[model samples]
Target: MKLIFGIGLFLSLSLLCYAQEIYKESMSLMGSDFEITVVSENEQAGAQYIQIAVDEIKRIEKLISSWDQSSQTSEINRNAGIKPIIVDRELYNLIERSIAISKITDGAFDITYASMDKLWKFDGSMTSLPTPEEVSQSVARVGYEKITLNEDEQSVFLKQPQMKIGFGAIGKGYAADKAKEKLMQLGVKGGIINASGDLTVWGSQPSGKAWQVAITNPMDKNHAFTKLPIMHGAVVTSGNYEKRITLEGKTFTHIIDPRTGYPSQGILSVTIFSEKGELADALATSVFVMGIETGIDRINQLPNVECIIVDDSGKIFTSKNIRINNNEN
Candidate 1:
């Protein structure tokens, strides 16, 4: 169904001052909300930097957006099984990394997920489950193994005619990382690039306090219970509590497994902290599909990466390196 989804609401710590004020600009980009914050000397400089950040994100969209018919991503899909499409080096690198991640996650996170046919509805309209044959056929063309990459030619090709790729899950985070890089290169001392709930922050706020993220309590769903202080890193939280598909008396989230062609269940939300927003965003979705136990174990194996999982029972789980303290701000 070409689903474009993001996490729940996240609250950021913002502090301002007269000498060096914190300026923020919020806008819609890549079919999702984005906020760019920077530490600037005055309102005029802040405006210019924000515009620069916005322009960089727009450039990324032009490269990776599947909805845009002229985008390179669309061209790759159009040439599936016909011929390899030469793409920009940036795009080739992104696809290469995506394939690596797919291998490690055991098909839980696959860009070829776009190859799946939309056979289920999440708006309570689906009262009966699709036949087993229908479910299997929906994901027949969805396989990461079918995607081929040639580094020498900087080209991408799909072995199957119906195979397709989309970056709906990781594109926002990639754009956020790119925007942060552009802002930092232009001499912006401190800032944050928040693409919906996937965020990347560096330096500190103008008031000198470390950047903090307040994750929503799954039990409450509306109010945040704990605040996590991050000196510098990326945090991406993915959840499916808002949308669900009902078949018979069972309920399923909107996040479908590309391999099994079934909705992932058991975990309510997953928040991943990593060195890059792209990794954090993809890992968050991967954890959801991997379930609670396996997800925590996989995250613990990676160095400098941690995750917080809230299961359907409102119970919280964390990786080996994480320690949640509600007392600490």
Candidate 2:
């Protein structure tokens, strides 16, 4: 199951100036809802800018989609353990970054987690936990180290035949980043590409102020705990509250720890603010699996990155840099 985040609902009023008009569009992409907003002089110009973003995101989805049999990603998976498959430089670099992140998080953020068998189901069908042996066997082929990349040839190889890689963790964020870059290149002064909950924004809103993003409360999705002004940056939230199951009086979330092949515990949600969407997305998932203390410590070591973690008990823990509006801590 994929992790869901409470969408940052931004409520902005339009300005009087026609040159600073804010045009918005919403559509479904990559199995999630994507909303694109552009601050432009006219509606037609905004539509063109949005079309560019949409096309760029579709192009990225085609390159990294694992379900599409003819995609480059699928071809790479098809040759797993048999031979190395050469791929585009963009994909190769993305995979390379994924491995680096896996190392940084100590294997907590592994793309090879796709190879994990579905031993634990979050759906209502699950009545009890799997046996210890069953749990171990499920992650037999799941390891970031098993993915071998040849930088010279730009090829990827899986050590095991059953090993596979999926970008469910970071693909949307990458798409958002790429789309934003494309818009900027097209001379878009201000816009937002919100790929599901992983969002990237540049420039200010039509009101001549930094974009206001409301961080929704995990306990209450309708209400926001705080609103932050983002001039230019990315924000990603990973939460387990939406998809979970309770068995034997114990609750299990949808986010499975790549190292343990088990659902994460204690953390209900993790929201990360960073300069890059891909980094924010991966770190959000890493924080969930790393637990509260270790995750907070890890995030603090990195510069220009902040995180807010909500535990099962509804207590909020933040990195040194984060400042909530209402709460002093």
Candidate 3:
């Protein structure tokens, strides 16, 4: 009887250990691929959780997508310089936060950048650069200060008629954050939401280890320069390796600096890790526009945020708090 009782206890422990399994689902949403992974005891539960995440992301896209004429974001852009449009609390808050990020980054990350004219093309068909006057005119209406928010009325107004706001940079990350939050609320133990490359994770893998993320090398797209062990939080990478144009023997990236109305130069890619995907996404773009020196300085001032910047010459610059493992250089 004693031997039988011991065997039963051991079998119970084994069953418990086998119950923890990780499941994943990937699909296209918000004009990008969204991958959701969750740990569960069975496949059904995992699928259900992933579905919930998918539904939540779709809901957010409907609310914030500028392409959707009925979306509040579209309404705000349409009425730019015309009238203040009342918006849902969620969108109002997002715009408010975007403005705050613009202030923090000293206009390096501006939602009003949407107002800039597309003077530069990166499709390899461009033979010459735009004239200096044309470049200057392109960003005439781009200014963060032009965005006005009314807290009492929950309205957003663009002071200039031609000014606009778009979330091409931060929307995916924000959706990732919201999806993660919703999953956590649904009692998910562990999961990852990867919106295009803006990834956010919570909890650990089924093996009880942290999630591992690889930072792709801008120069060599197939290889990763470093890998990071992330237990929680978010990671976002902004790079111009794939989209760029060369004119007069100078190569310009697709990422434009709104302040100067020109493509940002000297940085191939910038990756940022932060507590929220929204912050990480915006900062990655901001750093690319800010350049290495000012960008690294700004990141160093923020606690719990780290960055890795690869210059145009393949030089790597990291924030003071970051320690890279298996650095290629």
TM-score versus the correct structure, for each prediction: 0.91, 0.92, 0.94
Top candidate on lDDT is: 3
Residues 10-85, candidate 1, lDDT per residue (tens digit)? 1111223437888999999888899888999899999999999999999999999888999999999999999999
Q: Which portions of model 1 miss their true places by more than 4 Å?
A: 1-18, 124-127, 325-329
Candidate 2 global TM-score: 0.92
Task: Give the per-residue lDDT of model 2 (tens digit) for 1-329.
Answer: 12222222211222234347889899999999999999888889899999999999999999999999999999988998899999999999999999999988999999999888887886788877898898888788899999999988899999898888999999999999999999898878888888776679899876679988878789888887888999888999998899888888888889999999889999888999998898999999999999999999999998899998888878888999887755532
Candidate 2, residue 227: how far the Cα is off, in Å: 0.4
**Over 4 Å off, model 2:** 1-18
Q: Model 1, poorest ten-residue lDDT window?
A: 6-15
TM-score, cand. 3 vs. native: 0.94
**What does the lDDT come to for candidate 3?**
0.89
What are the RMSDs of all candidates, in order? 10.3, 9.2, 2.4
Residue 222 alpha-carbon offset, candidate 1, angstroms: 2.2
The full ranking of all candidates by lDDT, starting with the best, is 3, 2, 1
Off by over 4 Å in 3: 1-14, 325-328
